[model samples]
Target: MMEFRMKRISRKFSSVLAVISIIIISVMIFSYGCVKKEEKEITIGAVLSLTGKGAKYGEAIRRGIELALEEVNAEPNRIAKIKVVYEDSLSEPQKAVSAFNKLIEIDKVSVVIGPVLSNEVLACAPIANLKKVVILNTSAGTEDLRKAGDYVFRNRESAIPQAIKIAELCRTTIGIEKMSIIYSNSPNGKDYQNAFMKRFEELGGKILQIENYKDGETDFRTQLLKIKESHPQGVYLAGLVTELAYILKQSKELNFKTSFFASAGIEGSKLFEIAGDSAEGVIFGSPAFDPASNEPLIRNFVMKYRQRYNQDPDFFTANAYDALKLIAISIDKAGYSSEGVKNTLYSIKDYPGVGGTTTFDSDGEVIKPIRIKIIKGDQFVSFEKQEK
Candidate 1:
């Protein structure tokens, strides 16, 4: 009878152990299912000039976007997997419109990043506003882009700040009292010209001469000769990089020794490659792009960009990178809806970006510090106020 009692007690203990095991297994399965269900996905679209005239800008933007997407995906606590679909705008206005439509209609993307040039953005902005979609323009810095509507936001500041800064640097740092302006007869060039002239005159500088040339014009001997005859202390050239390079080469041919100031348009390698020796000592205002910045965010981005592209990141790439980061941040805060993203964008402030800390202003424009860089020797260096 004692042996029977011992066996019965052992059986009861076994039954309790099995019931606990089932309960633990049930809880484990439920937790696993919950985790699987929590995984989310989002799709963003990019409409860039992937080919034709604006290909270089598009390529930089694409690289930045891809880098941001990778970094976001690798975050251990990230709830959503982000993806970007790209459409080539060919740097044409109509093509940009079509690309924008395709991204919204076909890909069903509520947010898009791109159409890098001003004209492309202008072309696509109306449609975006109509559809109530959100657009984060990476590098379109034209003055009129600020009026593109509430749904459109740009990562880079408008050309006005660079113009003002360039003028200030020329007058105060370079000690220039008189300057000449040569600009392209395009919207981009016209905007820079107006802004610079207004700011320079306001700062007590004399505008000795103003000249304009049509876009794609290779020969600038006439304009350069006219500018040289003005006897100005400096010259500000505002136009595309290729044109700027040719103008520089021709200015050199004319033995013009005046200081040279360029628009942010001259931010690429093409200017140096084509102008060669003429590019030395040329100063321009760009969104700050110092890879040696103390901010770890900037340092890491610089390192990753260099590692992936095997080249130094420029202001354009930095702007695109900031745009992507802002978009991701908006998505996290506002969910995957277009209206949510648009609302969050306006509220973003002090966003630490590789370009600079960005704060979106009331007009959907970005406000950030612009750096004055001089091409010293073979590289661009930030111009210090104390440096002679």
Candidate 2:
């Protein structure tokens, strides 16, 4: 009887061990399957002017995105690995459309960022909508983009803020009653110039003259001379940075001392580099200011940017970083689905960004502060912050 009892006890212990082993194996297989199933990858497209007049701005934006990606990946709890594929628009509208199609149809990117120039953004915005992909503008600030479609979102403030701020600054600070507007005969230039003209006129300021130039025109002597004869208090330039620099140089040579003001087209350091001392004392309005911003994340970004690129971060780059951050936040908040991302972006309100706090209004316009800066000693110094 004792031997039989011993045999039974041994069998029972062996059976319990076998059951525990089977449970451990099953748990291991289930955990492995879940891990394999949960790996998600996201692809984003960056369509920028990487080879034309806007190349410098595009490169700066790319660098900013690179920096942001580094920081994002370094985090301990990232949801997915993001892959950014770049397409060069060359600052041409048709090329921009082609790139957009490729990104959507071939690369199959879930979302797209940029086409830094307003013309390019306008061209591609429709394609993005037709394809049901989100097109977030990092640098382009054309007012018409707001009405392009529901699929488009601008990270930077629109031309309206710039127009209103410039008008107020000219009226209050400079006491300028008369202004002359010179802009390139392009969609971007005309749009900005019109908005500024409207606001300036609304402030009881007289439009002394309005002149137009082609995009690649090297000689602005005729236009500058015409504006000089008008003798306006200020000459507002709405065009490419290269053209603006040429205008300034030529104006100075002609001994024209009228105060010069520009939209964000003149906010780049390369603009000053190209124009030399001519850029000094020139007032420009931007959707963002680098030094005036007090956010810690922005400060760190500036430091890292300078360290890596040996250049000061401009509004273009800062805006690109903010766009990426907005995408990341949306992904974190709503998961990695296209609809979720779009909904999150549309719902974003008062999100603190490097450029400033961004709140997307009904028209997909980012409501933020616009800042006016004066070029002093080869640097942009803040003159005033315009609250929106």
Candidate 3:
């Protein structure tokens, strides 16, 4: 009887132990599945001018966004892994529209980063707004963009602020009572010209003459001659890099002695190469981004950019970098969906960026403080304001 009872007890205890083991194993498997579910994935798109007149700017912007992508993925607490799709806009309006459409319908990306020209951005704005897709333009700064749509946003200031700043400098700082205007026939140029003229005249300055040259026109001799005939105290050149350089070169040839002022359109080493010594004394308004800045965020970015690209970064590069990182953060705060990101963006007050502190107005437009810089000995440096 005693031996029978011991055997029964031993069998029963073994069965109980096996049941407990199965329960523990089941719980472990469920936890693993939950963790796997938490690690999500998202996708974004870029429509850039990969092969066209604006290719260089687009390439710089691409480098900026890529660097941000790396940082975003490497964060340990990131809620999602992100992938980017690229489409070449060729820097044309019609091409930009096609790229925007494909990204929305085919790639199914909710957020997009580029199409560097103002015209290209304007072309894509309607579609993006209608589809509820988010577009953060890196370089386009036309005033018309202020009313483009609720879904369209830009990293830099519009033509109005830059134009107003330059106009103020011309009258108060440079003490120019009379000035002439030379502009390109593009939207970017026209916006700057219109705004600057209105502001300068408001400040009691007189406009001597206004001249315009078509886009892709390498020659500005006729316009320069006409400007020289005005013989104003200063000339506001609202043109891009190549055209501005040519204007400076030709203006120098004509001995058009006057103060040269420009909006934020003229930049890059190529300008110095083409304009040569004529680039000197060309003052322009620039967003406050100095690579040598001691601010840790800026310093770290400059170091990383140099290490990767083996070159110093510029204004456009910095803007693009900020644009991508902004999207990533907005997505994290909200979700990867376009409506989520757009709502979060509207709630943003002041965002600390590598370039500067960015704050978007109700129109989805941002305006940072502008720094006055002058070309001195083939390099840009801070210009000192004169005492009143």
Candidate 4:
């Protein structure tokens, strides 16, 4: 009886061990099933200022990108839905680099949209090149950024065209033989000043004086007074709209009545709002102006922007919208692969955009139309359109 009782106890213990082993195997299988493997998605990244001095511009760009994605997703036959992630660069170089690193290394985005400022773009270029991520810039116009890497692409014309346009205007329309340059000492400003000076001198235009103001400096009365004393035939303001407005208002106050030919700084409506009547008659180089442009895409975009934001789309916003569409089109044409997209984008020739027909050269700088716009009665009126 003792032996039989011991045998029963052993059988029960073995049964319990078997049950426990079965449960352990089941749990292990369930956990293994629940473990996530690496999944791939169509990822794109954007680095915009969004919250700093250039917030308005950044917000507009972000809105444009969002709208493009919304449209692409709404299509039933869409190739593959893109997942766009954004980081605020604050228009700073280091921050821009960090944003690029996060997008490339962390998010694994195949394509990147800009750090809008030229300096920030330049800072982020090396990283994009190293990571083999395609970068498309909407607004950074520094000539050097275009040549930063083979993967770098831009939708906007650089300051060189604007400088040449202004030089032509100064020589012909304004009848200015001698001119003075009042430029902010930022990278973009300095780039515009240098390009304008070089082109103006090349065009046989004389430089009466050149003055530089540091960025974020509110006081330009001293600069205005100096420009006034120089008595230039025309004054080229090479800065963002804020500084340009200050210079214009101060020029008016200081009785400096030199006809102004500006760079792309005066492309937005905010310039007119900031400078009021003082902004009138100011000729600036722009990509194109079509309050009544016939392009259906532009018309649709303008209508949508007005309906949603209750404001007209500026050149920058238009460029941003086109930038996203260009990327989308490239991806679609390339069959949703990174190499295909890059190769297709490089192969894109004479792709018509809202701004104009854009063709990427060997260096990826977009060759497109550049226009000259004159501010007339609180509106930008196109004065000239040069087709490349």
Candidate 5:
């Protein structure tokens, strides 16, 4: 009876010991897999407006990122080959939220670089903050993006700087004593108009007229005629590339030959295509990389971008390129984790990039100098920089 009892006790003890050993081995294996996963692959995601009103800008951003990733992946000493995944937000806020959720929950990306429009960024940025993912917005310039979250960062300057620069250029460089303004009825358009008017008047320049049209308005003959009646030396037009192009075309049709000063939104080859000869001599503040630049980094980037896309790169391209490079720099400097990248991004300063010397301020807004350009013939030539 005693021997049988001892045998039962020995069997129970052996069974417990076996279970403990299995659990330890399973935990060790799981931890090793996680370490290997972190060391091998880094996933990045994007929520871009590939099929909506913001498609052109989004496509440019996508191309820039692709070019940058190609170079990054080719580096032999790279920590991990970055894998990018994209979801089209269609430039809609609700769609952008869905895309953000998909990237964070399904794709498991540590960082995201898009949602190109300001409205889209506004929708997606808070979710990124909650989910502990880093978001780098390439070109969304609305002041609303500034309030998104600490995880939100922008690569382009907002309308304030561009608007102020335009006002200064009209006053100092062009010597314009009187200006008429026309803007689209969007948030950016309204904000830019107010900024330019405030700064221009403060500089002792007169605003003769202020006109506005809806975003998709086709006929601007009334506004153009009113602006013509003002007889201002300079007409400041703040709008998207398409709207500005249409305005230029219509203004030319109305025989309004007054010199035009536009926002950076008009800085692209598409404007010339739409407005043709009407785009000539149109001065605007541009964030584009100078085509006549001799800098090696600028030259190399331009060559590669042109070769890949078969066209000249614009500010959108340059800013997007810088965005990806900044992300990579942060990842390398502070590891691939979300918190690590977020912390490192704030520490970056004086990053001499092809776009400009990029440095993030306390609000995660990029501070870079913008150049004033004149649409001379078939090209945009650098007229000068805003006087201090």
Candidate 6:
């Protein structure tokens, strides 16, 4: 009996040892810079809304990422051949968490590019911090991301910068002292509305009324009626292209003659396609990217993007291209470890990107110039040019 008990105990001890060995090996490879020279390729994960409501943005972003991937692989001084594994987030929080777990566990990726929406970032950022995985957010611009731990870094400016700039422009430039806000009733939309409201109020503007609508709602007539009744000098919209386009179109149908304003993220060609002439004269703030730019970096990126995608790169595409380029640069400079990537990204200073100069602050938020843009005829032109 004693001999049999000792045998059982021995088996249990060996099992525990095996588990520990596996964990130690995992930490060495993933947590620390213990990559082998023989390993020629490193896999990174991307969680994006490949399908569902945010699909348009995802497709545009995918184009930029693919272009960058081809360039990265063909570089003569490349660190390692990089592969990006993508999972559909469906633009939902729970789905994003699942995608993140699968990437970190099954795919064993130390870095991930995105959970495209702001709420998705809020959902996955905790796990990113706990697991020591790096997140290079492609386009989620809520202010809350500034506190989303060191592992989270953004490729684009947060809604705070653009929101603040738009509010200032509305007050100082457009001379609109009162407006009404229509925003999506979600994490991202709420953040954008709140930022703009606070700034506008500080500049002595009165928000006649505030209204929120659920995501995926087609008809915004009811909200428009309420906003129209408020009789504000202008109306500020904060939501996706699908919803915002409809809002602009319906506002015109209702004959609500107020000027229209929006956030940077809403600048997409689809808006013009949907709203037609209603989209003209709408003002917003953006992170200074001009497809017509004479700058070599901007020109090259625009040319390549158009040649490959057969479409002009918008805000989403510009950020996605920069995100991939930064990721490759980070890996080359600081190995494939998560900490190495995080530290290197944070250390970046005024790195000229197609989007703008990218320099991360202490909170991992990108520092870039935000300029106001106006929809004129069929283009987003610099508002300053009109002033000049």
Highest-lDDT candidate = 6
Indicate the residue-level lDDT of 348 in model 2: 88
Candidate 5: segments with Cα more than 4 A from true spot: 1-39, 385-388
* lDDT of candidate 5 at residue 217, scale 0 to 100: 76
Better of 2 and 3 by lDDT: 3
Model 1 off-target regions past 4 Å? Answer: 1-39, 385-388
Write the candidate numbers in order of decreasing TM-score. 3, 2, 1, 6, 5, 4
Quick one: how many clashes does candidate 3 have? 0
Please give the clash total of every predicted structure, in order.
0, 0, 0, 0, 0, 0
Q: TM-score for model 3?
A: 0.91
lDDT of each: 0.86, 0.83, 0.87, 0.80, 0.85, 0.88
What is the Å distance of residue 347 in model 2 from its true position? 0.9
Among the numbered candidates, top TM-score falls to 3
Clashing pairs in 4: none
Itemize residue pairs with steric clashes in candidate 3.
Answer: none
TM-score of model 4 vs. true structure: 0.85
Instruction: State the lDDT of candidate 1 residue by residue for 1-388, as single tens digits.
Output: 9999999999999999999999999999999977875576788999998987678788888988888888888878766888899999998889999999999999999999989888889988999999999999978768899899988999888888888889988887668899999998877788889999998898899999999998678999998899899999999989877889899988999999889998988877787788888988898888866876868989899999989788888887888878878888888888889999999999988888888888998878888887888887667777764274
Q: Can you give the lDDT of residue 64 in candidate 3?
A: 89
Tens digits of per-residue lDDT, candidate 2, 1-388, equal 9999999999999999999999999999999976764565678899988998889889988987888877766666576777789999988889989998999899888688898888898888777778788888888767788798888888888776786788778876668999999987877788779988988888889999999998778788899898899999898888878889889988988999989998778777667666789888888788764754567878787888889888778888888888888888888888866677788998988887887888898777888887788788888888653232
TM-score computed on alpha carbons, candidate 5 = 0.86
Q: lDDT per residue, candidate 4, 1-388, as tens digits?
A: 9999999999999999999999999999887754522122478899998876666678778887887778876766564677789999986789989998998889888888888888889998888778788888888778897679977888888888878778876886656788899987777888889988887788788898899987667789988888788878888988877778878877887777878988786666667666788987888888763646867877887888889988777777777777888888888787655576678778888876766788888888888877787778877777654212
Better of 3 and 5 by lDDT: 3
lDDT of 6 by residue, 165-257 (tens): 888888987799999999988777888899999999999999999999998898989999998999999988888888898999999999999
lDDT of 3 by residue, 1-388 (tens): 9999999999999999899999999888998876875566788999998977678778888998898889988888777788889999998899999999999999999999988999999999999999999999889878899999999998888777888999998998768999999988888899999999999999999999999987678888888888788889999988678789889988888888888999777877778888999988888888877876889999999999999888788888899889888898899889889989888777777788987788888888886877878888877777753221
**Model 6 alpha-carbon drift over 4 Å, by segment:** 1-39
- In angstroms, how far off is 16's CA in candidate 1? 11
C-alpha lDDT (0 to 100) for residue 313 of candidate 6: 88
